[model samples]
Target: MSQDQSDKGTSLSLEQILAQAEQDQSVETDYQSGFVAVIGRPNVGKSTIMNEMLGQKLSITSHKPQTTRHRIHGIHTTAEHQIVYVDTPGMHLGGKKSINDYMNRTANSAFADVDVILFVVEAGRWTKEDNAVAKKLQNTEQPILLIVNKVDKFANKEELFPFIEEIAKEVEFTALVPISAYKKINLPAVEQEILKFLPKQNAIFPEDYVTDRSTRFLAAEIIREKLMRTLGDEVPYGATVEIEQFMFDEDEGRWIIHALILVERPGQKQIVIGKGGQVIKKIGTQARKDLNNLLDARVHLELWVKVKENWSDDARALASLGYNDNYSS
Candidate 1:
């Protein structure tokens, strides 16, 4: 075995290591790989689940709904399989802005080409939005794995039965797995279920690859996540981040990033900047810490807020801001 496989084998129990060897010998190193789309309403923990499964954070997350604006591919590779998880924006209703349309369109399109769909829903809570997602998936041929997330919220396990029954009536899922993305509960079962449906094939991406998005895109997302967590209720919906300059300064041995935070109204810009620039300064500090982890090097980040005046609602402006449907690695 290769050194990489040997390293992975060291973590397994003796029985598990033997099982792995037996399986490898039986299949003669057969590999399974495919795409899995994570779909749900806002704040249902779709991104969190994907991040946990990949053993790292690839998608930006916040308590705010619609935080994930773009489709991201979080690729997880092991010796046996490669699962490219497609993380999508939450599907919601009653938003007419161009950005809203873009988010919903990005989510809808993700279901088309995926090998499996992880339909995530909060345990004991089903809304019109969840119903809408279920309705949309009524005729899809791909295997739908109903992930009843956040079950840890319930103190008693029996309480979940009723909610599970309710969900069973709504979605015709191939399998139902209860989990808590936050608590890391039953996550391994989720992976096992997904493997059952994946087709046997060669790896789709290099084993060292973790995501399909550019590092610059992830930096912008990290900045936006800080903005979403820092700003108030209304401002985050109208706010977006654009990376103006991203480069490695060899002399300084640090990555330098200049980001512009755009808002639809001037008041929102003021809210982001705060009374004495304290809020934006805090945002910059938080984002810089995450950027240091993401780049594995010192980062010099500069942030500025500007009034873009309905950039979220203008198609050309949205496209310019990287909201286009053709966005790719």
Candidate 2:
């Protein structure tokens, strides 16, 4: 057996791996490829915008603020160009936990070494968090594309002009485009703006690869998303998911996954499990549906809840749960 099977954890033979590598290296000379960092404050539709651009959901999103805890890359490739969209955790000011620090550091680091920066903000809603993000972008050298998302909420397009002008004063952007990522309104314009700054180079990742993260990492996120969506405000923020076992069962012809949900306190664990285990069951059902879609195969998912006190605050525990700076697949 090879030392590395596959980054996505699919059991591919050496020949298949070599064939994919050959395809990845055969990009045309005129191909335009570069990184575009999607950044903003929490729940400002940054992840939604990237998903709209890529026509797929690579980042786990929820209505809750600070739902995205890590930086994820969603890759889009075409005959003409390849755009790697870096979806980061929403930059915020508060929260002194270790995970919060990790997320903020990850978002800050993404600003460097990127071809363009997509500074996303809600259409009619602007806050101090948005101002903080703008201040950080002022020092960046890359072309900042100010993306005003959720314009569909406004009935009158003319109302957006004043709002756009207000943001213009705060962010020194190369271009400004208003879009509704949720409604899929004018997402192409956002892509067009990104292409204007994308460099003429070869593809960074394999065309077949949609993301830099492993299937294991994605599985954990999917499970985490369900927890975020289903649980209450307090418990979800205190919770994190860890994949203990992720492997394919050849005899059964399905993927088997075991996940451990860590919480800060014993009461939180009980809350996650719910009365008669109903809550956990519902979360599992919802997560399994998404997991099947993500893996494109049948999945047998097992979920368990445990109390790991203050894991989010503990630096070592945070790293063990995949909150580290080095997010190597």
Candidate 3:
């Protein structure tokens, strides 16, 4: 037996493994493909669940609410099913700005024709935001899988049963599964539940594809994530990231990315730039490392903090920042 086979929990022979691999390469008769929307209020781990399902870090994560402000599509392909997970911004009822209105519309628009919905909430706790999310998602015919996230943080495991029961009373969830999206607990079960609703069809995308976003978009998001993590409360609610330039040199096997960190005020810019440029340098370093890993090429990143006042409230400003969602739902 080969070392790979020995490491695997299965004791099948090499011929059997190869045969299975060949058989599982791509079968169209029973193949499945559909979209699954991960929706919930902010900080409830909706992005975390999408990342775990796709086994890639495409969406940004931060302790601050509203970290995800757009709809991101992350794809997961396997032998039997291809699940296109749509990670939407947290649906909230708190703001009146155009940006907030855009975010709310973007999230609600994802429910048009999805095969399944993952309504994620923190384990053993319920808040008004949760009620609001449930209310918004009401009257949908599609099946919803209630994903109770952060189960590892719960003090007692027994609370999960009653909690699931309590949440079930609010909406007719097809099923409820407690999982820690951060720790990847019970992920296979979650995957199985979603696959039950997928239609029998061929893959919608190339087998090796992972996402619809380009490298420039991902790089800008990486920088914003670092800024959100490092600055925390200092990062303004209207903060937005834009890629000024992204260039690649085939001969040099390198990439050059120039990005602008847009803030609403001078003080926020000062905080982002930091004293003696330490904070900006740290953000560039972390973002470069991730960019290099993502592209498998050396990245030279340049960051600049610029002031863009009240862009969140202006309609034209939101469009210029690429907040439009023209998905063919």
Q: For model 2, how does the per-residue alpha-carbon lDDT over 1-329 read when each residue is reduced to its tens digit?
A: 11132264234432364456456656657778888999999999888888878888889889999989898888899999989889999999888999889999999988887899999999888999999999998778999998888888899989888888888888789998888888888888988888888877777666776777788888899899999999889998999999999888879878899999999999999999999999999999999998888777789999999999999999999888889865644
**What global local distance difference test value does model 3 have?**
0.81
Rank by TM-score (best first): 2, 1, 3
Task: Identify the runs in model 3 with alpha carbons over 4 angstroms from their true place.
Answer: 1-28, 326-329
Better structure of 1 and 3 per TM-score: 1
Writing each residue's lDDT as its tens digit, candidate 1 over 186-233 gives 999999999999988676665666776677788899999999999889
Q: Give the runs in model 2 whose Cα sits over 4 Å from its true position.
A: 1-6, 9-28
Task: Show pairs that collide, candidate 2.
Answer: none
User: How many steric overlaps does candidate 3 have?
Assistant: 0
TM-scores of all candidate predictions against the true structure: 0.90, 0.92, 0.88
Of candidates 3 and 2, the better by lDDT = 2
**Which window of ten consecutive residues has the lowest lDDT sum in model 3?**
1-10
lDDT (C-alpha, whole model) for all candidates: 0.87, 0.86, 0.81
User: Clashing residue pairs in candidate 3, if any?
Assistant: none
Which model scores highest in TM-score? 2
